[model samples]
Target: MGGFTLDDILATRKPRDSWWTVFMVDPLACRLALLVANHTSITPNALTRLSMLIGFASAAAFTEGMLVAGAVLFYLSFTVDCMDGKIARLKGTGTPFGLWLDYVGDRVRVVCCAFGWGFGEYTRTGDTDVVLAAVGVVVLDLFRYINGPQLKRVKDATRALLETRLEGQYVLAESVLRSRPRSELEQAAAEFEQTAEDTGATVVDLQKAFHARFPWYDRFRVFLVRHRVRTHVVSGIEFHAAVFVVAPLFGAAALVPVAAVAGTLLLTFEMFLVYRVWLASRQVPRTAAEREKILV
Candidate 1:
């Protein structure tokens, strides 16, 4: 299990590149990580555990008001965080357990960082708000974890619907074009045209009807309504990193509170995106047989 290489995961047909993977800069670093994994006996899980340890050390440094030390540790931990998954892929050790461990490690890292921020504040000004904000961050982090499975199901369902609809439409059109007799072909073409027209009209009518009957339904369209905002919010995580980088320039303890607020808000928005995706998925149709199989 742990001895497997990235080629094995690739054999499972996972996409080499995805939005999240691109955001993490995995593609650029994959080759280097692969080389390192191939020559080393270090397991991906060990890397994950090492990252957690580094994160803990970083938090401890922050709590002690050792800003420079804490920042360095945080960045190092982040590097380890990035390396673990790449190593897993490169080594073909990317098991379900390894994935689960990596995810759990990330959540723990965030929580530890939040707590470290609170500790830093306590060491400087004894403020309770920092601790409260840390707790809030953890709560939002849990929200994301809870919504994960639902979001996956929703995405899968949406992909299935689009594929099925496109395939069905193509087959119907081709069948009409390849009909045996001229009259039969003409008749088939007529039926096809009617279907095309009816589908178009039905979609337009449904959109109008839906808007008129449920004006609020537009809010449920995840990509249209929420994607940009979510992207912006998630991108703010880099801002937190920037703050840590420049902490020494701003000696004022007030900056810690500001960073805490920003972190909490970002985490909350991420959870909101997950929830919205899950809700949108609930609106998608499932197979009739599957539906019939439901006990309810």
Candidate 2:
């Protein structure tokens, strides 16, 4: 019997996926992963390591100016990359180390591919500009990827602090007024406070509390996610394939710089959007008490 059904593979997808990934690459990769699922002994981390190994091979091929070979290997590496998560979700074997490996492996792949492009172009035409473009690709892409998650971390921490501090004020009020309050409204408040004190919330819970408080923030997040199609092409494996595979088919290493420049510009715009969303999230009132009356 097959370890994964079609629905099981589909269930591993992110809520907001790029059109190319959703329609093209992911479906094919998931099907392949499902076929291989009967093997049972292969783990997600093993797939991750395998993907990284193939990624290094892709980089070496690019460095040798074997564009078509590099491109094919790049796509294969990416397909394997997608497989790791699919396998993890299929087997319920996702781990913190698996996630860490996936994230770090992605960064390593970017660095290797970037340098490969520079080295390949240098071997072809000896242009110093190729090196500069590689640097820009790494800088802009890393900035966009790293900053988005870090900003979200900041927002989570700030929201948690606000929830705790504001609730502390309420607790202090209840402690000081123990002798004076016996009305029906006060009894309800006391009960609610007791319940809140008993059930402590995590950072994620506080973020959800804020999400409930601000409908627009939730809507805006959805909007950003849905509108990411424009930046999707020059990201991930697609970027490498465009430069390494398609460029050589046309006999033009010039496409290397072109992709690097386009990726930089796309990521710059994405960074701006990320910053705007983070700013908007920060503008929301953090305290649930303050946000209770108005739906932001």
Q: Which candidate achieves the best lDDT against the true structure? A: 2
> TM-score of every model?
0.57, 0.68
lDDT of 2 by residue, 160-202 (tens): 4555555633332223232332223355555656777755421
* Local accuracy by lDDT, each model: 0.56, 0.64
Segments in model 1 whose C-alpha atoms lie over 4 Å from true places: 1-35, 156-257, 264-296
Estimate candidate 1's alpha-carbon lDDT, on a 0 to 1 scale.
0.56
Q: What is the TM-score of candidate 2?
A: 0.68
Clashing pairs in 2: none
Clashing pairs in 1: 4-91, 4-92, 4-93, 5-91, 5-92, 6-89, 6-90, 6-92
**TM-score winner among the candidates?**
2
- Across 84-199, the per-residue lDDT of candidate 1 in tens digits comes to 77666555666789888888887787777767766677667877766776676566556656655666765556545534544433322223433233324446666666887745
